[model samples]
Target: MTQPTPDHHGIIYRRAALDEGYTDKQLTRRVDDATMTRIWSGAYVLNTGETRTPEELHRLTAIAAVTSSPDSGFALSHQSAGVLHGLSLLTPQLDRVHLSTGYATGARLEKRRHLHSGALDDADTVVVDGIRVTSLERTVVDIACSVGFAQALAAFDSALRNGADAAVIAEYLEGHKRGVGQARRALGHADAGAENAGESWGRAQLICAGLPTPRLQHEFYDDAGVFIARTDYDWLGKLAAEFDGMAKYQRHLADGETAFDAMRREKEREDALRRLGVMVIRWVWEDLRRNRVVPMVREWLDRLGIAA
Candidate 1:
């Protein structure tokens, strides 16, 4: 008998073949040849190679294998579902396998799988790569409803900018019999144009440190109406805040002829802002993470007479 082609999860057996004696010794031989990689006890892949991360490949395999289990009613949810449905921009950080199943099924996987039980309507779900997942709108709503507003806004912005359909998402929420109210409320507050994460973090730190919300991406003009410097975050009457991403600077410095030349150009940018009466307070990644941010930012704002 011809073997079934491996599913995305890498399972090679058909439903009817499970009763037949498929020895582990035979499977191990296939694995040795790199023809199949055993993901779980019973799951095997015929063609997936080592190019992809183990977690990613395992996630797909887990999703696929879950279907054959007694709890076949589960749908993919959260970030896993988002990734599968092409809604999430961030790659999976955890090896977590998220699945949603009916409460009646009472089926559960090991600790590696996170299971949610709910009555999901047809509109709230979509089939992705033969696995059911929460629809784009539902995924966004689920994230917004669970996370804080700022994070929700960031995720929502990324989703919209990456071509998530607002109407379709809204429709899915509307059609959701369960959690409709919560979803609608989150949708109302969803903003798809918040500043990037770095800018947002910098702004939050400044505010939390008693600095006023600076004008973001502000353009400065000379008395003659000529544009001078476009600052990342600027205060109207006195101060300016600049977030320097280390990676960005590293890339710029790498392209420069020498480290000193790159340093000179950076200093010049600061000097130009200073000449325009803008007292610049620069922050690097380390400052943001250390909680030393508030005191330093407060000191700078105080120097500019802009501290609250």
Candidate 2:
């Protein structure tokens, strides 16, 4: 059995396969045998039986959507472009591949693609892995305009951290009139020090609830000037907040260290911070998702006599 080579984006176009001397019957047989999976019409990816992450699968589908589209005027946009740009999004809709054409053709949703029309200039687009996508700032602004405040805050934080020009994004926001107010608010609050969407969402909750803004990625040093730990959020040297996601432990795992080990290290760090007169509080992903962070933080703030 011969397997067809996919492109750089892991997409095997049927037209390219035909040009490579693969017959339709062979391709169909491979699909029947589950060796190849069709992501879009006339586009397939070799199914090696390895599980794909949601982002990875969505990116592949996005590539397939772009590959199968006859018109080249449209570029990957919105959440699709956000995926390509590596921006942290909150519960992004992966069911559709979002695209934007340069001209005003009006937005439409088809079988697998959501086509958006906007006035896109050359600077508004970039090529990622040979696929045309909206520029990072454009993608962030587009996302800010389309999604809610908290979700948009996450994207804006990520984009700023990724070196997207905040001024340009602000300029782009001025051009949009529909949801510019929310986008402006998010941009105003966006901080690059937020490491991920979880922290951004947490901060968003605090801000919307009229809580005092916390210093992000605040570092604590021991009495001897030794660096202790960096926290996700710090308020008035009285409280430090952490977003406790399992992925965080996994992401920061030291060499030869297990997740449990990472957690232990984190606990030790928290203890050190607490010894330095800082109250440490942590909330998990579920807490944030269920909107418990605000009240939890408020209680802590009230107990500590830190005015909200």
Candidate 3:
């Protein structure tokens, strides 16, 4: 077998492989031997034995779906385009590749591909990493209309942080009847201050539970005005909440600093906030998964005599 070559994006399509003088049998044998991964019907990516995140795998699959199709019928949309645009989706549908088509009249799902029919103008499409996809604002509005509130809020928050115009997103939602109510509400509360998907998700949970929306990325200073820390969620200058995802700690690690070292620094920062008479609450990913954030926060508020 000759050594196969993939394109710059590390994707090799069947037709391209055949045109390059590779036999169909060779491609089949490679897939059977686990040397190449069949991302879609005729698209392949070399297997390097490294596990890919769900987002990465879905991205490759979406690329394959678009490239392998016989015609230019659709562009990646919804959570598919969201991932490509670097938007964070709390609970994305990873198993299916979503494509938007202006020619089709409705939605269809088959063989792990979702075909959505909609009016996609020139303004609603963009090319990301060599693949056609819905623009950032369109992707956010699409996801907002198609999924749950928490997931929509996460995407909205991420889009805002990525410099997507809120007015443009609102314009996309204007007079759109599908999920405009919740999408509009999500946009109304979306904040660019959210540092990541986890913080956005935690805030969404609180809001869905009828809690007051907390101020995001609130900073604390010492008596002499020296900066102490910026919290994930701050309420009334009396309480602060931090989402304890491993990524959060990893992001703060300096050169030669272990995660433990970063954690120690975080503890000291929290201690400083405590000294300022602010109550600090921290929750991990498991808490969010188990739906304990609302009750836990409510309990803390009641115990601290803070008005909910």
RMSD of each: 6.6, 1.6, 1.9
Q: Identify the runs in model 3 with alpha carbons over 4 angstroms from their true place.
A: 245-247
Q: Which of 1 and 2 is ahead in TM-score?
A: 2
Instruction: State the lDDT of candidate 2 residue by residue for 11-74, as single tens digits.
Output: 8999999999999999999999899988888999898779987788889999888867888878
Model 1 agreement with the true structure over 166-226: per-residue lDDT tens digits: 8877776664555556545545544444345555555545544545666666777768887
Cα displacement (angstroms), candidate 2, residue 282, comes to: 0.7
Model 3 has a clash total of 0
Instruction: Give residue 143's lDDT in candidate 2 (0 to 100).
Output: 87
Candidate 3: residue 286 lDDT (0-100)? 88
Question: Considering every candidate listed, which one attains the maximal TM-score?
Answer: 2
List of clashing residue pairs for candidate 2: none
**Residue pairs in collision within model 1:** 9-61
Query: lDDT for model 1, on a 0 to 1 scale?
Result: 0.62
lDDT of 1 at 188: 54
